[model samples]
Target: TVPGIGPVYTAGIVAEIGDISRFKNHNALAKFAGLTWRQHQSSKFSAEDIPLTRSGNYYLRYYLIEAA
Candidate 1:
């Protein structure tokens, strides 16, 4: 077993993300999964309590949090 990666979840994640290579890097992957936190910036002053955007693959996000 791979830590928290249950067989069923692994299958679902892999099936959802057909081509991992489509993502350029880890940041891209996280963004696709909706795991990246949002940011609000203005002339070098940034907000820290911004919320996460709901514009990504929810299925992938579920698996990611489960794995964590």
Candidate 2:
């Protein structure tokens, strides 16, 4: 069970909520992977270049990354 994945990769996967389908497209997925440019605005709201949405399953993400 141990010595499977590392931390960063695990965190990245966990940060992604649901299946890859949840992403509108490949670009979206890449964005979540922090492999693309950061979005600073959404319509009328402005956001920072922070990581994935914290509203996501944090425990899962943390554990994922930890395991990774």
TM-score of each: 0.85, 0.31
How many clashes show up per model?
Answer: 0, 4
Residue-wise lDDT of candidate 2 within 1-68, one digit each (tens)?
A: 24876665565555555576788987665545444444578789987555554443455545555665
lDDT of 1 at 39: 75
**lDDT, candidate 1, 1-68, per-residue tens:** 68889898999889878799999999998899998887789999999888888769999888877888
Q: Model 2 Cα RMSD, Å?
A: 7.3
TM-score computed on alpha carbons, candidate 2: 0.31
Off by over 4 Å in 1: none
Our tally of clashes for model 1 stands at 0
lDDT of 2: 0.58
lDDT at position 7, candidate 1: 92
- Deviation in Å, model 2, residue 45 alpha carbon: 26
